[model samples]
Target: MRYSREHKLETHARIVKKASVRLREKGAHGIGVADLMKDAGLTHGGFYAHFDSREALVIEAFAHAMDRSTERWRKLAEQTPPQKRLASIVNSYLTPVHRDDPGHGCAVPTLGAEIARESPKTRKAFAAKLEQMIDMLAEQIPDVPRKAARKQAMAILSTMMGALVMARIAGSSDFSDDILGAGREAVLGRATSPKAGKPRARKAAPSAPH
Candidate 1:
């Protein structure tokens, strides 16, 4: 018995989806072809039939994982109040829950450093997906200009990622809290402050003119 093309495609997608979760749970280097195949309920021999190579699967899994993360954030942004969304996002991203549960968390702070050493194709896909995630984030900020929104999104993401990384490196709850708390305060403060992103207009010297 042979599977139809549609069935094959569906199976392939299933494999990739499962692989994405596993990749997020364990960094790309932490997983292997056999382990992913078993987790996906497929034989190792079938891996090549679905993807050209592990590199291909890595790219697909990276994109899929990022999509899941951003979609989760988008849902939260939609339901949460606009004024509080940035803080909420920052708090959630820097929590111990997120740090302990890499399987369901943001890939940027999880495997980003590892991905830097990966194939160029994987890096390219990651760059594009990150931009898409930023765009999704920008959508949640209706009051800001497109460029400003994107810049804000980038800043938020950068802070969140950096905070998470530092917390992990610090290896202590107190340090983790301090790192996350400081980052949250800085990001949310700037996000909520009236003068954020605006340049102060310099007053002219009227006496000098006279």
Candidate 2:
């Protein structure tokens, strides 16, 4: 039976969302298209109806995952105070709750390695979302130049992602907690203002060197 356009779109969305979760839980290549479709309550044969190929589904799924992550950070940042926004974000991300829920957490640490080896199209799509995430993070930083803030955000995110991977590898041991703690401290340090709650004012240039 043919489905209506709206229904088809809804079903396609369901598949992408399901795939997003599964792809994070499992590695990028760990689960096949059939399993993803099955999880989405559809048949493997119907996968092509929504996507041109497995890679297509993966690209969309990865983008969906990153979008969800960005939305989450946006909400958190909204609730947090201006000066503390970046710290709040870092703390939220480095906790056990976030670490234990890769399916719902940030996609960078979970899917970064696999995406590294994916087709250029997939990597390009991932990079596009990654750029948005970096920008979102940069917005949380205060008392810094935009270029410097973005650079700091990128460094902070990279450190956190690597620490998260290590923490996951270490499991629930002290090592895991240590990794998380270190990650939080390292990133939060960058996010923290040197003087705390005070902006560094740029000095005025002398008038035409008089």
Candidate 3:
């Protein structure tokens, strides 16, 4: 049956998004075209109708995942004070919760090593999205020179990604949360954890008349 262009476009997007999440959880080469198609509720033969090649799907999906990650961080940063923007991003990203959920968290820590080994076209796509991320991060650091801000953004991302990788590797181990905490502290100069935070103090009582 012939599907309308709109239907086709929606299906294509669905496939790409499914591929993005699965690939983040399972790595680029971890899943196959047939399985990815299956997860998208399409047959293996139907895959060719949407994408030219599995690598094409990989490129699109990786870009999709990176775009979502960037959008999330941008929204989060915008909601905070200008000076606290970077720290807000760091605290949110370098958390044990993010560390524990590869499928839903940032793509870099899960897919970076695999991306390095992908074809030039795939690598190019990855680099393009990465530039967007760096730009977003740089925008959050208003106090530095643009060049230095870019560099700092790179440093913070590298530290966060590395920490995420290490934390996942040590998942469920004693130091998994520590790894996340250290990463947050390294990026923000202090750490905050949803787990370790104290309850808000009650309002102070009015002073008695002297």
Candidate 4:
């Protein structure tokens, strides 16, 4: 049966949405095309009608997951005060709820390492979404130049991602919660510090000693 163009687009989006969740729950190579199609309520043979290859689907799914992540952050930024938006994002991202639910959480910490081994096209797609996330983060950062905000965003993302990954690896909920708390404190501390983004002045050597 021939589906309408709008229906086909909806089906394609459904497939990508399902793939996005599965790809985060299971790494890039962990789930198969058949399983993803099955979960999306379609047959394996129908996969090609929407995507050229499994890799293509994976790339689209990664982008979709990141889109959801950034959209949530954008909303958080809107509701939060300018001074507290960054910390609000960090707290929301590092919670035990997010830590326990890889299928529904941000794709970066879940799939980043696995995607690094994917093809150039896949890597390129991932990199593009990552940059969008960084830009969203940069916007929440207060009182810094754009260039410095970008750098601070990078640090904030790195800390959150690394801490989340470690928390998942530690195999205990208590430990996981501790990791999240520590990570939140560290990132927010740096971001809210009085001298954040400023260079330290070098001490002058004593002329008499020379």
Candidate 4: tens digits of C-alpha lDDT, residues 5-85: 999999999999999999899888899999999999999999999998988899999999999999988887898789988
TM-score of each: 0.82, 0.88, 0.91, 0.89
> Each model's C-alpha lDDT?
0.74, 0.80, 0.81, 0.81
* Candidate 1 TM-score, true structure as reference: 0.82
Q: Candidate 4 regions off by >4 Å?
A: 190-210
Q: Mind giving the per-residue lDDT tens digits that candidate 3 earns over 80-107?
A: 8899888778777866567667887788
How many Å off is the CA of 187 in candidate 4?
Answer: 0.3
Which of 2 and 3 is ahead in TM-score? 3
Q: Per-residue lDDT of 120-202 in model 2, one digit per residue for the tens? A: 99999999999999999999999999999999999988987888899889986666766777787787663221111123242
Clashing residue pairs in candidate 2 are none
* Clash list (residue pairs), candidate 3: none
* Candidate 3 ranges with C-alpha deviation above 4 Å: 194-210
For candidate 2, the lDDT comes to: 0.80
